[model samples]
Target: MQQGSVDAFGAPVSADTLKRYSGGAITVNSTQAITGTVSNDSASQVVTGNNAITGDAFSSASGLPSVIQNSGNNVLIQNGVIVNVEMKP
Candidate 1:
């Protein structure tokens, strides 16, 4: 993800946050399930489930577009931007 890109999860992340979590700048490497509410800030949020991290979140940072799978829906983030959100039927 690039700086200034807002993921489906709402607010424009701070530059520091972007630098910390951006595709190429990520430092940590691991896969972990995230449940409940995930938010970059008050304006941006995403509800996730046990399958939240199907892959390494940090490793996939440079993957451009990534999907955060959830029990309710799926969020698509491309180039650090929130491009599309798929709602469960």
Candidate 2:
């Protein structure tokens, strides 16, 4: 897999599983793009990346929250879940 190449999941991932693997922090390398579906249900999720996201990005429910940081250009985030997005320069 490339630095920022998006990959698909075989099935839906549970919150606990995702948290265990990522330790609540998911980082994307420079100039990377996430073009796959991201479903996070952890208590607190943080996604730090710098590049374009041309796919669906989702967070947790009201009880659980998420913080996503990425660039401001060519990023398309559309989901019903509520999350705090910080757009960097």
Residue 35 accuracy (lDDT) in model 2: 67
Error of 1 at 1 (Å): 38
**Per-residue lDDT for 2 in model 1?**
54
Predicted candidate 1 versus true structure: per-residue lDDT over 61-86, tens digit per residue:
66455454445543433233433333
Candidate 2 per-residue lDDT over residues 25-54, each given as its tens digit: 455444434465545434335554575434
Model 2 clashing residue pairs (backbone):
none
Give the RMSD in angstroms, all C-alphas superposed, for model 2: 22.1
TM-score of each: 0.17, 0.18
State model 1's lDDT.
0.50
